[model samples]
Target chain A: MKTLSSTWKEMKKYRHSYLMIAPYYLPFLVFTVFSVLMAMGLSFSYFNVLETPRLIGWQNYINLFLQDDIFSIAMKNTFLFVAITGPASFILCFFVAWVINEMRPKVRAAITLVFYAPTLAGVSAFAIWKFVFSGSEYGLVNAFLLKAGLLMEPLTYLKDIRFILPILIVVQLWMSLGHSFLAFIAGLQTVDRKLYEAAAVDGVRNRWQELWYITLPVMRPFLLFGAVMQIAQSFGVSAVSINLLGFPTTKYAGRTIVTHLMDYGIIRYEMGYASAIATILFLMQVIFNKTVQRGLKRIGE
Target chain B: MTNRLNRSVGGTLFLLFFLGFLGIFMVIPLVFTISNAFKPLNEFYLFPPKLFVRNPTLTNFTDLKQILANFWIPFTRYLFNSLWVVVLGTGGHVLFVSLAAYPMAKHDFPGKNLLFSITVLALMFSPEVTKIPNFIIMSKLGLIDTYTSMIIPSLVFPLGLFLMKQYMEDLPDSLIESAKCEGASEYAILFRIIIPLVKPALMTIVLFNFTFVWSQTSGEMGGGYIFSEKLKTLPYVLVQITQGGFGSMQVFAWDGIVAVINFLLISIPIAVFLITQSSIVETMATSGIKD
Candidate 1:
């Protein structure tokens, strides 16, 4: 009773603080928190927007796992994307940022802009990729390969199931140097210059040794942040698939969890099934992020 | 810093060469988009395709104007809608997120850790998971098809709050304590002391919010909430044109115009980033996630 009273007293004292945050927190509650809970709940029931949601126990999830072939394809493709793009982008961003850190400030800023430009271009830039991979002799890659005598026929890249996933991975890696890259560049700037001097005095013989010992240790937090960002981005790889390969690619070549959710939720109005997919994805992301966080914590230990 | 290990000449050259090679792929699409916008009809369909325009012309821009002139809604209306959402969304996001971030960073309140943890957890997952529920909530609240549906969700971007709080935590407690000793209120101190000191973070948040809002298509942000033709955003209109919604114009000329529209859509956010680029680096210096 005394502890409860003291907690109430603390809350009363911080009333002004509560008032200040209410504008943001209230909307956050409705849009993010409440919506997350609602998605979890909706995963257990069936609703098509035309009728009331009816409780069906675990049927939706059972249907998703046991019956849905497309869901399995999406799951396999999503895992493939995350496994490849996540680590590649993380290491790529860090290495690029490390290299860029060695340049003069003006050059650093300009190089940063060049690498970050594709992400800034947003989805509209996908048009340029379409033109490059237009599946015709006139397409940029096809033309170049043909001129070099490397190809006898034009390859329909986006439409070909064999080529779609790999091409998407490349395009994804191209745009992957985004916020996390900037975070890394900034993180590098924050490492105390004195540490490098100390490491050198301690007989650190090479740049690689210095990086492993000093830079990686100091950059642990940023690395974790970068990992989380990369995981979210890699797992959420839908826009590229939807834009480049159309909504449903040949043989479901590039279907991901998000695009699957879009298929059922937006087009078919299978709200329950879609919510189950989302719930599974949410669980995968949260669990994966937690694992990465735990693993990052062990770095430099 | 000067006593650090010197990079080998061969290694340095190899790294630079590697960067240059990757940089070409990084830059080609953007260059092609810009160049295609200026290419004439004959150049657009040239055999073995040209990466640059040999003969630049203003016809693509004029042709785009003509195509847009045929839309049911005036082109200016789309522009107006975009500006309205971007300005308000970015402004509201920066202000409200910072306001919330201040207390989280500096105050000793109940549930502070829990609130911060929740926000971090929110950041881990993609927002796409919540789209269905958010749509249902929006319809329940009758915010569907309104500007509020677009602007309200942006005000609480978890990353913005996370970055702002991380940046603000580096501000010395002595500053806020001194302000308090001078009889300043929390709001006054935040505006007078915190905001000025954290200008880099503020600018970074502005750039992020601006980029997000500016590039969002109606289907992405509004999530099918918007139904009115007049309420659609500029990107939505540009996307429609590229999808050949404005009707079948000459194929080659339309492709050039599509390129022009892509260039226009991308350039503004790039400009915003250019203005705020330095501060983003500065803000990110302190944006480490503490365990």
Candidate 2:
């Protein structure tokens, strides 16, 4: 606390610089960073919608890990989502960008738009998936498979835990191609064509060799950027769960830490439990980011 | 000649395969969304689903017009509310981000690295994780259920700041140095010299922010922020209409109209993307992923 005061005094000397940055950092502190800290604080206290929060240190965290079965299930499901979607989508984005990077400018634009359509449609627009996989025979999946004689009966894709997570993964991947894909496209364009020319002279006889040795090294930054966005987007899988799988989802198959947070925060009004969920989710994100960043260092090697 | 033909055949086949996969997963669903907007009511519940409309009709849109006519606050008000909010939010975000980004990108100020680091670290956690605490903060500041609540939080998008900073770093330091030698204040350097040079980056911010805020109006996400009907946004109203939560008519029975409404809601951002395609894609390419 004493060091904070000293830093404040020192900050006064460069107040203008601080002031210039304040419009962003100040609101960011108040809205984003402060709220995050407040969430950490609130995790230690009990508060329903009606009452003032009461101090109940460690109870929420204790119950979250030990007593709450659903939280564990949510964690497991969330890990499954992140594990499956993050790497799969990142790899997919890179390769697609590589392929598209070879096309003429007009062709590249059209293909990029085709791939980027869903992302532009936004999360809400993904509600189309609900109708596409709707339980009724009128649903797109049921109609096609049945017409093709693949199934005698239409399965309830969203309601069935067996199919929900898998279907959710598909829709998640579809929307996941947005920010990272464009970044890779742009990054690929930024990579010098002369490098490939030089690599060929250096005995890089194959496209794979060229990609591994030149393209990958040059686009490492884009890969890392795409990975971070992928990780965050995949881990933060609430809206898809809620819209596609239904709230509290059947057998808790679609439940993730985020949906659980929403369960407590919005539905049950258990602010403390919800904040605890938020904190744990935040901690998970921080850990994943740190681990991936450390792993990126080895990419150049 | 045969060898060249063989290689070209293989490449064409690969392209076909890629397009086939994308067509099934990406293209068809989008085609469904657009075509289904014109679908007839009976076509919606048909035993076998159809992708293209059998008979195109304007009934769904006319129904929408009727519904819009009956809204207590009138439909144009919601439209204006959403437009102004997006304009203000996106406008403010582009300005503030670029202002901060100039110093962070160009200057050798104390704690600059730390400031840049905080924003980068903040990126890993989207607003969803902190929505509850943000709600609490908004309520404490009496901003909940107000336009300020939405606008203020959005004015400092972390991604936008990082994007601008990365772009501004590409600007030559000599540009700012010469201006400084002439006794121009940091503010003048930023407004007069820095901004004009970084117009493309600024356009990128505007396009991205517009799409983001435009899409956010879908009531499921942050619909809880504004309670008053007049303050509500277009997408929020679209959600309400789709769920049959608004309007007294038996509109839910008409899935075609609801689908049309959903299509209409999503089209705005798509238009914005097409308009600013170059900057958005180019800016994203320049977006470096690591420290």
Candidate 3:
């Protein structure tokens, strides 16, 4: 006891550094590490808070990948959502940012804020999109079409699988435009204005030529960064879609992998199956991140 | 000379079209939300939608009040709950992230590199996958339905820590070493030397976190609307209002409430942030520039 106490007192001599770090470090370890380990453990068995986890081995994973139709839908839809929205948002935001960056600083800030305003709409506007695309005569889009003398009847935009995915894509595009747009704008500002002046002196008459010669080359890292971020973001579509459109509407078109996990975990209390779905999502995201990183490095080099 | 004139006209037209599209895309929804709020009950069903309200009255506002009364709890309580989470969550995040980031920024502490890697990896794994386990852990902590549960789980601010670390790394090492050599304690160095220098980054962190946290708290993810209606946040309340939680006659009325709250909740902070330190946005953007 005396020896241990002496050792502890000696350790206290360097305690200032650790104490400075302890507040952030200790809580992070507990919640992040401990919580994550508990989740991995939960995947091995059938445990809800109500009862002891029954050991189930690989049964949960097998059923999830093989038998669960909803899981399959979730995988397909989520990937498709990521594929479409990710690149489109990036290109569009980059284009806008590039244009805005050409303007004076105040004008650039004004345009940037104008683009950022949609994000402020948050999910509330998305909910309004439900009304906008509502199937009935009450729907704004349908009502517009009807009054335009274009259509004989109202279209059920949310219900059909065809329209559901497009609706989700458009909404995602609208909300996501601002943040990455800001990121790209920030990236654009870093380009040396001297590069453009030199290019113009060399008789680069057009914007496209300037972009190829000056902007893209200079802002490659930021562009790659924005692209990867968009990919990560578009794949993370579960929260917004799930909130706006509940699961299993018109053949489960809107379900994403995260929503699938949420269904099993939160609503169904199937902790094991949920964990399995999450594990797959984690694996897939890891692959996507790696591919993008490789792509960035290759482009950079 | 004529060809040059034509090209200039074409360029201007292209800019106008592009800028116009972006403007409409951003503005229409805001216009829609505000327009819908003011639309009379009969106008809600009108085809092609009335662009402007003919009889704009306090009726929707009055109806919103009546509808709010029908809720299991008062609408203002949800507003307060949202405000509470933002205040505490933002405070906790700003404090802890700066605390953790300052040492990592200045000191060559052991395991700093490893700690940084962990934080970066944490950002990749979105909260979606972790929802189940996090929920279970929250339940175990007896925080499932409380305001603390909503705020505490996300309070780690790993992203903020990384941002703060990146920002603080830009500072000269001599700034801190001088303080240390002056017989100032580590805490004193952090409090006196570090925090003051990182004001722009601090503002950026606060702005981004405020918006992010505000948006999240308004959703079902925070369990903001599930139980204890009094504890529901503004977004959840808006959801309820939209989904007809207030009953039929009061739908437009409730829409007004949703509008007012959403506008108030977001615009107040944004206006304050933008108005006071609009310059910060440019500075932060430039600071973020890698040169």
Candidate 4:
């Protein structure tokens, strides 16, 4: 009885600890771990979501890497988007954050909001921007270009394949300004003011030099994090691209991995194939994240 | 000395010119959108894009009214859905995360280090990887398209968990020990003692979740809207409008602009949330860093 009572006492001590963490941990284990295990298992089979999934055994993956033309295009577009948006957003965001950080405190906060505001704007703002960039004669972009004598006629920005991806890239940079800018701002705030002051005393007078030796080296972790996030975000560019600009753009330029997944999963009812694509996307992100983590570790050292 | 002074002046002028160029590039879209919101349809189509809304009318507002009428069914319901989901969802997140965070940050449990490491590792997984499995689970539970589907899945935010854990790690440990010596229950200790101390972290989580939840509805419009046309959120309605493809041009009306404006109106809560919480947001960004 004494032993049991002592055990109960011990258990009671840990009860609150268990309760505190369980809400997030349990759901995470189930949804993140269990569901992922199930998805991995399901990827081997032809699951229509309703019907019992039959074991197809690697055929879905086989087809994804081999037979699918749309899959190739989707993969290509996703890579292209990552290539374009990742660096463009990162450099632009880092520069803006640096500039904002250079300002006085009140002015800095206000301008940070200005730069970050577009990111908070999200799709609603994107839609408004879409109107401004519309192909019509009255569309602000076209109207301005026409007035400047750059072009005699309004260009079909969304419809034309040559311009669609770049347009998407630009829109993405603007909308995502907040997250990366905040990340950069977060990074910038951590730079040792003493280091900069010492550098200034040693004749490091320009913004460029101070940023190079003091700022960049100090903010390396944040820079790595922001870069990784941008890369991951750019990789998933299909969500906005598909929604804003339809798939099979005049040249199939904007059809991304996600678009292909939606096409198969929702439009075509090929859940098995879609699951395979999702699996590949998961693998790619994991690799990218690990690489960034390694990079961050090196920078930390 | 005069030549050096001239060079400095020239350089300053060049720098100002460049800054102005970039500023204009950044500001034009913003100015145009706000201006166009108040402009008449005639002004919208004008070449050189009228810099001012000459003869600004409430026509846009009237059009907004018509669109709101058409969209009224879905818009309000969606707003309510998002509000509850974000509120309850973010609340649950903050509560659970802080609870978990305090233990990991402060206490030396049997497996604390292992648990902390794993939690940190979990932060690396992208939401896309987890989303499908989450959707499947939601479907299995018959929670698809319901508020439960949206809110329940988000309660376990890895990033929030990580951030909270990181924030709490810096907290002084004596606070917990003092409360313990008072013979306070652990629940009392956590709820009464630890939570209030982490107001900044809590506010950051709240503000982050509020903005994220609002924007997520915009991005994942189809998932939340489900089959109920009346249940469609503001962004979902805009998506539907856009996705309907311009093929439905016959139905195009002035009301479309109003509908868009009404969509913009829904952003006010988000804006206010950001403005009020801006300081907290700034702190979260800058607090531990070199600044």
* CA lDDT scores, all candidates in order: 0.86, 0.81, 0.69, 0.66
- Give the best candidate by DockQ: 1
Highest TM-score among the candidates is held by which one? 1
Off by over 4 Å in 4: A1-13, A199-207, B1-22, B70-78, B110-126, B219-225, B238-266, B281-291
Instruction: Evaluate model 4: give its lDDT.
Output: 0.66
Model 1: what is its DockQ?
0.73
Between candidates 2 and 3, name the one with more favorable lDDT.
2
For residues B1-291, could you state the per-residue lDDT of candidate 2 as single tens digits?
111111255665686688668657777788888888888788887768877889988788888888788667788888888888888899889878977898788876678998888888888875677889887878888987788876876696788998899888888889889998999998999999999887777878887787777766665555557877778888877877777777444446267667788789778777877778888776876688665
Q: Find the 10 residues in a row with the least total lDDT in model 2 chain A.
A: A119-128
Model 2 steric clash pairs: A186-B285
Clashes of each: 0, 1, 1, 4
Q: Candidate 1 residues A196-249, lDDT tens each?
A: 888888998777888899999899999988988999999898888887788788
| Candidate 3 deviation (Cα RMSD) | 4.7
Quote model 3's TM-score: 0.88
What are the models' TM-scores? 0.97, 0.94, 0.88, 0.86
DockQ of each candidate relative to the true complex = 0.73, 0.51, 0.41, 0.36
Off by over 4 Å in 2: A1-13, B1-12, B247-253
Error of 2 at A260 (Å): 0.5
Segments in model 3 whose C-alpha atoms lie over 4 Å from true places: A1-15, A198-206, B1-12, B69-76, B224-226, B246-291
Which docking class does model 1 fall in? medium
